[model samples]
Target: MHVLLTGASGVVGRFVLKRLLDDGCRVTILGRRPVEGFETGFCAYDLADLDPQLPPADALVHCALVHAPGKFRGGEGDDPEQFTRLNVDGTRRLFEAACKAGCRAIVFLSSRAVYGDHRRGETFSEADVPTPDTLYGDVKLAGEQALEGLCGPGLNGIVLRATGVYGVSPGLADHKWSGLFKEFAAGVPIEPRKATEVHGEDLAAAVALVLKKTGVLGAPFQVYNVSDLLLDRQELLALYATEAGLSFDGPAASAATPGEMMTDRLRALGWVPGGRDRLKTFVHSLARRGGAGT
Candidate 1:
C-alpha cells in the first residue's frame, strides 16, 4: 500500500510512520522542514501550499497542526479567525489536494477538545452533537467538517478524536512529561490533574487498523474516541512512585470529575487498548533512559 503522511516528525506521526513502514507501505511525508534521520520520501512544503499531485499515494493521513503545550500564543486575542486559518483552512487545502490526487482514504487527526469541557458526570459519544468550548476545539471541529465535505462517496474519511497521549520517545530529556514524571519518581511533592491518557504506540496501531480495514467505515465522517487508560492523578503518581521504589507520602487529592471520552466504539471494532501496564512501561522506559537521574 502507498500512503502519504503529514507531520511525520511529530510525536504521533513518528509512530504512525514506523508502523506503516513495518507493514510494508510506501510513505511520502509532507512538512515544513525536511526531516533529518528518516529515509522516506520527503516533501518540504507547507500544508497550505503543497502541490498534491507531486507525489501521489493511495491514502493520506492529515496529522499536521499548530500546537504548543498551552494556549495558542501566535494568534490574536480571541480572534477565532486565526485558528480557522491554520487548522480549518489548512485541513481544507489538504482534503482538496488529497481528493484531487485520487487518494481513496483520508484520516484526520482530531481531538476530544471538540467535545469541549463537559459537566461533571457527562460523557461524550460519537452520537452527541459537538459543543466546542474553546477556540482550539472550535477550530478542530471546523477541520473535521471540511474533511468530510471534500470526501464524498468516492473516498473513506475518518476522524480520530484522541485524548492526552503519553509515552517515552527519543531525546527523552526534553519530553513534556519529563519533569512531572521525575517529580513523581523522586517523591517530590506535586499536584497533577487526574486525567485520561493514551499510549503513542496504541494510537498508531488504531490508525493503522482504520487504514487497513477495507470498507466504507459505516459512516461518511466516521468518528472514533481513542483513549486507553483512565486513572486518577493520585493513582498515576502512586504507580510511578512505586516503580521508583518510593511510597505515597500522603493522601492523594481526589480525582476531578474525570475528563475523557470512552473508547467503546473503537474497541467494538476489535481495537484493544493498552491499559495501566502501558503507563508503567512508559515510566520504566523513561527510567532506563536516564530519567531517574534527572
Candidate 2:
C-alpha cells in the first residue's frame, strides 16, 4: 500500500511513518520541510494549496498543523485563522484529492482539545457532541467536519482524539518529560499533574491496528481517546524528585483529577500502552542534556 502522510517530520508523524514502514507499506510524505534519512518519496507542499497530482496513495494520514503546549493561549485569533487554513481548508482539499486519486482511507489526527478543558468527571465518548472552548479546539473540530464532508460514507476516516502523547524523537523535545526533567535536574521544584499520557510507539501501533482492518470503511471516523496511566502533580514531583535526588514541593491540587482522555475504545481493539518506562527513558535522556528541570 502506498500511504501518503503529512507532517512526517512531526513528533507523532515520525512514529506513524515508522510504523507504516515497519508493516511493509510504501509511504510517501508531504510536509513543509524535508525529513532526514527517509528514503521514501517526499513532496513539499503548502497546506493551503494542496494539489491532487502530488502522489497516488492508498491512504492519507493528515498530521500536519500548528500545535503546541501553550500555543492556544497566545495564538487564539491568529492561530485560528492559520489553523482553519491548514487544518480545515487543507483537509478538505486533501480528502477530495485523495478520493479522486483512489485513496480510500484517511486517518486524521484530531485532539481532545475539541472538547474543551472542562474539569468534568464525564468520560467523553465518540457519541458526545463536540463543545470546543478554545479556538484551537474549534479549528480541529472544523477540520474533522471538512474531512467528513469531503469523504462522506465511502472512505474510512478515523479521528483519534488523542491526549498528551509523549515519546523520544530527535529534533523534538518539548514534551511533558522535557519540562519535568529540566526542573528536577536543576534542583528546582517540579510540579506536574499526574495526567493521562500515551506513548508515541503505542499511538503508532494503534494506527497500525486501524490500518490492518480492511473491513472498516467509509469515513467510519472512529474517535478514540488514547491514554495509558494517570498521575497528579505531587505524585509525579515526588517520583521525579527521588530519581533526580532532589526534594519536591507539595502538589498543587489534591483531587484525583480525571485526565484528558479515555482508552476504552482503543483497548477494545486490543491496544495497550507500554507505560511510564518510556517516559523514564525520556527523562533520563533529558537529564543527560545537562538540565535537571526546565
Return the top candidate by lDDT. 1
For residue 282, model 1's alpha carbon misses the true position, in angstroms, by 1.8
Query: What is the C-alpha lDDT profile of model 2 across 1-294, one tens digit per residue?
Result: 888898788788888888888899988888777787776777777677857566767888887776554454344444556666766677788778878868778888888877777755556777778888777788779878877676455677777777777776434546546666565546665444556677888888888877776345323665677676665666656666666666666557655565356677778878877777766665565555655433
lDDT of 2 at 259: 34
On a 0 to 100 scale, what is the lDDT of residue 191 in model 2?
49
TM-score of 2: 0.85
Computed on alpha carbons, the lDDT of every model, listed in order, comes to: 0.74, 0.71
Give the alpha carbon lDDT tens digit for every residue of 1-294 in model 1.
888899787777887787888788888888876555666787665755644444677888877776553343233355556556766777787788888777888888888888877544467788888987777788779888988787667788889998877774432335547677666666667765666678877888888989987364676568889987766777766666666666677336765666668788888778987787777877776556655534
Alpha-carbon runs more than 4 Å astray in model 2: 50-52, 67-79, 152-154, 170-175, 190-194, 217-219, 247-260, 277-294
